[model samples]
Target: MSQAEASQLLGLAGKYRPYPEYKGAGVEWVGDVPEHWRVGRLGSFGYFIAGCGFPHEDQGRQDEIYPFYKVSDTNHVGNEKYLSKADNYVSKDIASKLGARICSAGDYVSQGRGCVAWKQEANSYSGNSDNKCDTHG
Candidate 1:
């Protein structure tokens, strides 16, 4: 939509005002949102949990393969068309120590820091391998 039309639709030029000087690329309105929309912080919208690094001692032992996910895995899922395989795998014990964050089908995972700009998508573990559940949404 045109800038003027969007502004009118959003009530940005009535009692509300727009900044003539642009500081960034997004549309910034100077008034509250419609009654239906609520404002809140990221913490209020959803829980933020940090991912932990598996210790070197827990690297690989060939006991029970556990899915080990990283930021690159997320990128692999994109454009690959088919299900992407995890490059790393750990033991069940290590996965257990990592605990609750080990991830499961339908869990949302994020790469934590460097790849924060990517969109989050819910993932499902449908592969036969038990070590394929570390997906981020």
Candidate 2:
């Protein structure tokens, strides 16, 4: 993945073209989109569950029963598609006490800021990042 290779890859992506006609998307960042496509807020399509606080000492334990997602877990590359694995874990009781928001079946998760790496899980899970995540149910 050299700079030239990266540039060439991005250049290849630039080959994609939009439909001939376009209209404003309302938001400043999203200037225009295909007229046929309708734009809406991300919150409109799904229920967002904000993360909550949890003691760090209870995290990073492999023996725990429930996975405890933290900011660091986002660093794992393969998990960008789905959160099948986590670097930290917590017990069911601990999670319940922390009131950590759990993702329902088919829910999607992503970081609140920075490079948004959205991923959906096949099953339910919990998080302890304290407002660093946006979980869609």
Candidate 3:
């Protein structure tokens, strides 16, 4: 989606009225935030993780026993409480080896390459390199 559209969908489009009082946030790019809200770097809240990736053959159409996310999934993420769809799946045995980077519910994922997009997983899931992207809890 275009930046403006994404902003509106993500509720960052200034739909809410401005706070009565405001102070400089110091960063020009981030002029100000709601007066009551404290400002801090995202890192202050959590660490960034580069997810692990499996081989190409390990991903593709399969039984839905375990969901696997990819960059495309971000386009479908909206106001939903959790991400509900994925393009790939794996068997329990494959999942066992891919456990190191299994995305837990509530984790935010962002693509690292082409067609970058982000999504917050609604449930436990997994992904490979294309979607191995960045993640933060």
Off by over 4 Å in 3: 1-16, 75-81, 91-100, 114-132
Measured on C-alpha atoms, candidate 2 has an lDDT of 0.59
Best-fitting candidate, scored by lDDT: 2
Q: What does candidate 3's lDDT look like per residue over 1-137, in tens digits?
A: 54456578988888765468776667776666556777778789877766456557877755646566556665565523345676667666675676535555666656564221223335533333554456666
Clashing pairs in 2: none
lDDT of each residue in 1-137, candidate 2, tens digit only: 53335547778645655468888889876676678986898767867766666565665588766666666665677555556667766666776787766555556666553111223234533343433655667
Flag the better candidate by lDDT, 2 or 3. 2
Candidate 1: segments with Cα more than 4 A from true spot? 1-38, 55-63, 77-84, 98-100, 113-137
Q: Which stretches of candidate 2 lie over 4 Å from their true place?
A: 1-13, 27-29, 113-131
- TM-scores vs. true structure, each candidate: 0.44, 0.65, 0.59
Candidate 3 CA-lDDT value? 0.56
**How close to the true structure is residue 61 of candidate 3, measured as C-alpha lDDT?**
53
